[model samples]
Target: MGFDGPTFAFHPDRRAQLRAELDAYYARLYGLIRDELSYILDPADVMGDDYPSETFRVLKNNELREFW
Candidate 1:
């Protein structure tokens, strides 16, 4: 479902771009802005030490490198 459409193959760069685009789309679909997306990606943006659990850590880091 979340692929490069026609190719439908696994290429690191293409997948990352698609994933980031999907992330942004869903965020907007839910009426969340950039800052809210940031917070959702890494809860630490809103809850620092109080919420030290790593949620979507890898995804967030990858998105930072590829899109954000």
Candidate 2:
């Protein structure tokens, strides 16, 4: 299986914004509440200071810009 549709180019910023929007839409469809989505984007919010390295930091930042 592969993409067969026409392709168009988008600036890096625009592509990130679009990806964030799509992720948020799917999160809603999957029944993720705001808090759940937030956690998925940034586990550090709920994790303790000694917790391991950050998770999805880039996605979290991108979503903050595009979703919030």
Candidate of highest lDDT: 1
Off by over 4 Å in 1: 1-8, 45-51, 58-68
TM-score for candidate 2: 0.54
| Candidate 2 clashing pairs, residues 3+ apart or interchain | none
Q: How many clashes in each candidate? A: 0, 0
- lDDT (CA) per prediction: 0.79, 0.75
Off by over 4 Å in 2: 1-10, 53-68
How many pairs of residues collide in model 1?
0
The candidate that wins on TM-score is 1
Query: TM-score for all predictions?
Result: 0.57, 0.54
Which ten-residue region of model 1 has the weakest summed lDDT?
Answer: 1-10
| RMSD each, Å | 6.0, 5.7
**Which lDDT tens digits does candidate 1 get at residues 1-68?**
66555865568888868878999889989999887787877788777857876679897677678766
